[model samples]
Target: MQDEPILKVVNLKKQYGPGCQWCSNGHESIFEKNRCLRCGTVYACNDLSFELYPGEILGVVGESGSGKSTMMKCLYFDEEVTSGAAYIGTYDDGETNVFQQSSQQKRHIRNTILGMVYQNPVLGLKMDFSSIGNIAEKMIAAGDRHVERMENRSKELLTHVHIPLARIKDEPKKFSGGMQQRVQIAKALSNQPPILLLDEVTTGLDLSVQASVLDLIKTIQQKFGISMIVVSHDLAVIRMLADRTIVMLDGKIIEQGLTDQILENPQHAYTQQLVYSLI
Candidate 1:
């Protein structure tokens, strides 16, 4: 791992609804889990902060409504953050807070510097577009105008993700869940981004298919040396992929460390429950 982080996030916060004085004044007493009982405001992500190192897979494990997915959405610009700062080592010398960038700048960053694969393939791929077309679309967004180059790159990525060349021209809508997810993975990698955000990418797949996708992800990371943040509720997934793990609960990171360390010696009660459940 590199000494400096490839991506750094500081005090990232995302919430829904306006906060009441009780919740806004740093009083946890007025909140129920991550929601403010008094004002009905939901703190979907509360002061999340983490770093992603080059060539490392960082696992974020949390149950439903725990804000892990919300955090990914905020990082990928799918949802606006209420407040926080993020710096990318390759963007502007890692000095600018990406959240404060203009929409155009953010779009540029999304298209070129970062890639995201949504848990639902529909959210990531244009289902009706040919699988290759979906990949070309992302390349085009990044200002690649050479049609031949796009096609070649798309084919290369698709093949790398284990999408059969014979089916490259087919629309994702006609694919099985596993195939669609593989196409989504190919599309996300079309830009050759330094950072990849995978939000529960294998959630609904069968066990065998999920294993295939996981192995593909590991292979991609090793081959491309891409830094990735993989969010999943499954500890088994985390163990298989992440070099480091961050355990989240109720919108906060309750524990984090080397994946093996966290698994073997879970300090938090919630993390212990998660670890023991894998037994």
Candidate 2:
């Protein structure tokens, strides 16, 4: 049906070192209680779970080391999942687990079904490639080979992200930080994936630049009607982009609800502190 969630995750966990006595018994909250006091294992994500509905923006916010990035990495398949399942409803009729898919299948999903914009532009863009080349790379991966069509689509996306068409032939090295980020956004959307994942995309930009990027993201979401999972440490950024928000601490979700509900009446102690601290 039209109401089904686009992405669903259940009991997702990622940890370093094998679980020992400390992980099994000593800590009540593995994420908050980072160290396995006895074994010293790091719990990057502990039973993290949530659902992303179609055409909705779901924000994941928390401090550094809160595992927000880890969760994103796992979903994008950049980091291997230690355990648990994540299902993309539009993938294989929603019956198959994404993490269990073969490497080739994972690559196909990453190229065709998912688009990601990383916090560091370096991670998302090939700095040496021209803006057009960058977007074309994604199209080629999705099986498009006609040069004319690729160039046209690249130009369309570059214009969509507000990058001037005149610089389409220039490499990312020639662009400013915010401009580079815009290029990455265009490339990620070149294939028009059903779901997009953004990891602290506006973190290092100037305040004015941040505002523009945020505006572009909102515009793109409205234009494409795509589902998005946004990870950020900035509540303001999340507030602007998310319909529903989830607050993560250590490695687990501490609170979740509509964006307005969470900001206006935060229930969790950490969430209250985080929300007020921003004020």
Candidate 3:
């Protein structure tokens, strides 16, 4: 049996405030440090733990401000886990403690070993560059790569994500939301990473489009044998896609079981409340 998890997170935490340059609201001062979410103050993700096995589609569901996105970022090496440990052991001849890497080292590992699908499609693609060019830039950034290799790989990944071969030339704004999401998926797959972090991939889409995208994700998961972590707020989404489910609340896991087990017989009051509301 496999001993190590394809992805493992333990006691992770993250806090944000105005000083983040990359965040949409650049934290120029103490007052503007974090994004203007409800409280307009710094937000933190406290202790959380979970695991994803190869070819597994694991769903994480919770209320707003539940740290789902932050945890996803920790897994993807974007917002580094401020405390605790994240163990990512890849079967493709790789093993690393994600929290231990420096920012530069983590950046190098991102596209090659960890491909992330963000909640906001805009976050995954570059704005000024052409869609294809943006992808090539990511490939180059993955390992200081050559342009040609990045281009060819970009085309291949676009094809894999079911993007029209020709659409690669257009800028991202020209595409529909669902279509732009496809481009984001293509970009995430560009480096052939073994693990994929999907943060609310279906948010804001109509149910029909949401189903299609989820189907595509399921198909790719089967084809590539990649382990995936899907974070979402909808119970139905979790019910439909997850092999196993971890119900989280207040920054800690409350219950975990086969998807059916939790849905049919929830052990925790918080899990029951969510399940009841769904029914």
What lDDT does each candidate get? 0.94, 0.91, 0.77
Estimated TM-score for each candidate:
0.99, 0.97, 0.84
Better of 2 and 3 by lDDT: 2
Tens-place lDDT per residue, model 1, 1-279, is 998999999999998989989998869888889999988999889898899999999999989999999999898898999999999999999999999999999999999999999999999999889999999999999999999999999889888888889999999999999999999989888888999999999998999999999999999999999999999999999999999999999999999999999999999999999999998
* Residue pairs in candidate 1 whose N, alpha carbon or C atoms collide under 3 angstroms: none
Q: Total clashing residue pairs per candidate?
A: 0, 0, 5
Error of 1 at 36 (Å): 0.6
Q: Write the per-residue lDDT of candidate 2 for residues 1-279, one digit (tens) a residue.
A: 257888999999998878786576646655336657566677888888899999999999999998999999999999999999998988988889999999999989999999999999999999999999999998998889999999999999999998899899999999999999999999999988999999999998999999999999999999999999999999999999999999998778999999999999999999999999989
Clashes counted in candidate 2 amount to: 0
Of candidate 2, the 10-residue stretch with the lowest lDDT total is: 26-35
Select the stronger candidate by TM-score from 2 and 3. Answer: 2
Model 1 CA lDDT for position 72: 92
- Could you give the candidate ranking by lDDT, starting with the highest? 1, 2, 3
Alpha carbon lDDT at 191, candidate 1: 86
- Runs of candidate 2 with Cα error greater than 4 angstroms are 29-32
Q: What does the lDDT read for residue 234 in candidate 3?
A: 93
Task: Please identify model 3 stretches exceeding 4 Å from their true place.
Answer: 15-43, 91-96, 144-148
